[model samples]
Each structure stands twice: as C-alpha cells, then as structure tokens.
Target: LGGGMTNAVLALAVISWPKYARLARSQALTVRQQPYIEAARLSGCSDTEIIFRHLLPSVLSPLLVMSALDLGTMLMELAGLSFLGLGAQPPAAEWGSMMSSSRSMLQTAPWVILAPGAAIFVTVSLFNLLGDSLRDQLDPKFNPK
Candidate 1:
C-alpha cells in the first residue's frame, strides 16, 4: 500500500508537472504585462527577480487550489491500483484490499464489497466536489459574466 501510494503520487507529480508549469508560465506572462511589472522592468529588475518577487504571489491562490485538486486524484489512483492487487498486501484493512478480498464473495455477501467500494466512491466524489468548488471560487474563468 505504501509503495503503491508513493508510486501513484510520483506518477501524478510527473504527469501533472507540465500543466503546473504552464499555469505558472501563463500567470507569469499575464503578470509581466501588468504596469507594475513594466515599472519594475524599467527600474532594472532581473527576470528571476520579477518572477519570484512579483508574479509568484499573484498566482499563489490558483496554484494552491490546483494542488488540492491533485490530492484527490492521487488518492483515487492509489485506491484503484490497490484494489487490483498491485498495491496493499493482505490483512492491511485498506479499502482497496478489502474490495479485492471480497471479489469472490461478491455474490454471496455483496455488502462486503459494496461497503468499501461505496466508501471509495464517496471519498473520491467529495474530493472532486471540493476541487470543483475551489476552482470555481479561485479562477475567474468560472465566474459568470
């Protein structure tokens, strides 16, 4: 389970990095176009100085929201891998492990599988809802014109 969780997190970080970089770059580009950035540039601010001192703070909110959204996805992927026996070992009491063990008994005691499956479903859903809410609140694009 630990290994699976680690792998999932690492994979997500790697795969999602480009998007994050793009967001940062886009934000930086926008910030750079602002008058304050122009003033700082005219005052002889370096590129790194402009980015770290000026642009970073402007994009912090969306960056934080995106990070929170990523957490839920990483959890779901870890649970999925664990459910497939590629994750948690036996007797660990993880939701995925429980579902895996209950597969054969699915017809006999559907509750056993349903319970854990439902838990995972609800957790994932809640995280997704939270992420959507955060995005809506943090990003101007989602706002009604």
Candidate 2:
C-alpha cells in the first residue's frame, strides 16, 4: 500500500505542482486586471474578498482544464518510473511495472506487453480528450456557437 502508491504520489506532486502554479499565476494576473476586478478594488473590496470572490471564479475554469490534462501526464510519468524500477515498486499491478516485469516474455508472449501498452495508451488518450472537452465547454470563445 505504501510503496508504489507513495512513490507515484510523490512523483506526481513534484511533476505537476509547477505547471499548476504557473497556470494559476498567469490566470490570476490576467483576471486581476479585468474591469470588474478593478471596480471591486476601487469600491473598497478587501484583497481577500477580491481574491476569493472574484479572482478565483475567473481563474478556476483553466485550472480545471489543466488539472484534467495533468492527470494523464502524471500517470504516464508514474508508469515510466515504474518501468525503470523507480516507481510503483514490484508486485504492484501498474502498467509500467507489468511491462517491465514482462520484458523477458516479449519474444515468447508479445501479448503480455501489448495489454499493458494498450491500456496506458488508451487511458492517457481518454484523459487528454476529457481535458480538451472541458476546455472547449468552459471557454467563452469556444462555447460560442
């Protein structure tokens, strides 16, 4: 329970944190300049109130989209680490671990590698698709139809 899972969690956090921070920073900077935000500031809204009430709502959509996209990337990273013996430690059923352990079986039973490879491909593709759909649905420009 603590081995592979912990490694994966740590890897994912290390890999994904920077992208999220950048996204939030950029979004907050842009949203902070919007007319409503400026008006709120001029009208005596506290910084905390402006941030939580106004800034967050505007920036949250992109955060959601990026988070969906990050999930797949993080999973792929975990699998790659597992394949390299750095993640999802032995005995775990992660696709990368499966692929790594089944390396010797590649010649005799290609199906073993194929199954995990296919799973990783499909799962990552699905996550990317979900992220794209959410981006389109949430963005005002994309939603206009």
Candidate 3:
C-alpha cells in the first residue's frame, strides 16, 4: 500500500533521482573514455555489451558508496518528515514520531527524548562511517592494515 511511510519514500526517491542519475552518468562518461572501452567498440562489441560487461562494473563501486551515504540521509529525512506529521501516522513507533511525541515531556523525562534522538544519531553515524570505510576500501591508494 502507498500509505504510511510510502509517500515520504517516494518523495525522497523522486527528489534524489536526479542526483543519482547525474553521478552515474558522469561515471559512465569517464569510464567510456577509457582506452579499453574504445578498444571494445573497435572490436565490434555492441553498445549493450559494452555497457553491461564493462561500464556497469566500473560504475558500480561509486554508486554503491553513494547509495550507502544516501541510505543514512534518507533515514534522517524520513524521520524529519514523520516529525512534521507527513510520514508515519500516530501510535506508530517511528523514531521521528517518537521524538515528536516526546517533545512535551522533554523536561519531565529526558530519557524519552534521548531514546529516539540517540537511535537516529547512532544509525546515521554508523552509516556514514560505513560509507567512509567503503570509499577507503575502494580507493586503490588506500591501504588497510
């Protein structure tokens, strides 16, 4: 069903689609200019074959890194939307809603506010760290010990 968090999900996807496409297209353009791709074309390889066999593999790493980063951003955005009453409905246990619902109790009970806030903080931090690690791993100059 296209209810609940679905609208936020769709909205974010639509909003971010252009950025993803531009990144992929730039990567593809760079990859295409590599000598190997030119050689593949000279060898009578079809466009589809060149794309699937060569370009996709080359572009996938950066896309994955971007996706990992975006995952965290998307989580935060969903939570923000939920807080604004545009995402998850009442009585649902979404972190943003939890924070929203707990706002009035902020002074009386600090733990209520702390819980969802901490969850969002930890999750976003972990994802950003994971993305950074992935980027470092993908870099040829990066050495892991």
Query: What TM-score would each prediction reach against the true structure?
Result: 0.76, 0.89, 0.90
Report the number of the highest-lDDT candidate. Answer: 3
Question: Which portions of model 3 miss their true places by more than 4 Å?
Answer: 1-3, 141-145
| Residue 108 local lDDT, model 1 | 92
Quick one: how many clashes does candidate 3 have?
Answer: 0
For residue 112, model 2's alpha carbon misses the true position, in angstroms, by: 0.6
If both were scored by TM-score, which would come out higher, candidate 1 or candidate 2? Answer: 2
As a whole number from 0 to 100, the lDDT of residue 139 in candidate 2 is 83
**TM-score head-to-head 1 vs 3, winner:** 3
For every candidate structure, what is the RMSD over all alpha carbons to the true structure, in angstroms? 3.1, 2.4, 2.4
Candidate 3 Cα deviation (angstroms), residue 17: 0.7
lDDT of 3 by residue, 7-119 (tens): 98888899998988998999999998999999999999999999999999878888888999888999999999999888898778899989888899999999998999999
Superposition error at 54 for model 1 (Å): 2.8
Which candidate would rank higher by lDDT, 1 or 2?
Answer: 2
Cα lDDT of model 2 by residue, 58-135, tens digit = 789999999999779888988898898778777777889999999999999999999999999999999999999999
Which candidate wins on TM-score? 3
Local distance difference test, candidate 3? 0.89
List the lowest-lDDT window of 10 residues for candidate 1: 1-10
Residue 66, model 1, lDDT: 79
Off by over 4 Å in 1: 1-4, 43-49, 140-145
